[model samples]
Target: MILLAAHGSPDRRAQALARGLRKGLERVLGVEVLLGFIEHQSPTLLESTLELGRRGGGVVRKRLL
Candidate 1:
């Protein structure tokens, strides 16, 4: 599983970008990918990571900026 964390935005355009990235990662990794937020959005890093861990033990990578 891969966890992508970013500074979320209230702007629709920014959110769409984030969602696009998440989808791209999912396709590239061929595994479950989680989208998380550092601020605006919900399901933060901690929560996403925990959920990923609970699902199964696997690689957890984060792309944060």
Candidate 2:
């Protein structure tokens, strides 16, 4: 699993960019890609990490942008 940590933004374009990156990564990596926000969004970093841990044991990598 991969966790994409992005700065949350109220701007629609920024949000769309983040989502686009996630989708692109999902296609290229061929693994489950999840989104987490540092601020101003739901399913924060802590929440996403916890969910990953709950899913199972695996090496989870995180990318920040």
Best prediction by lDDT:
2
TM-score against truth, every candidate: 0.78, 0.82
- Residues 6-64, candidate 2: write the lDDT tens digits: 87887878878888998998999898888888887767878887887888734555555
CA deviation > 4 Å runs, candidate 2: 57-64
**How many clashing pairs does model 2 include?**
0
Give candidates' CA RMSD values in order. Answer: 1.7, 1.7
Report the Cα lDDT for residue 28, model 2. Answer: 97
Candidate 2 displacement at residue 16 in angstroms: 0.9
For candidate 1, the lDDT comes to: 0.77
Candidate 1 ranges beyond 4 A from true positions: none
Candidate 2 global TM-score: 0.82
Q: Indicate the worst ten consecutive residues by lDDT in candidate 2.
A: 56-65
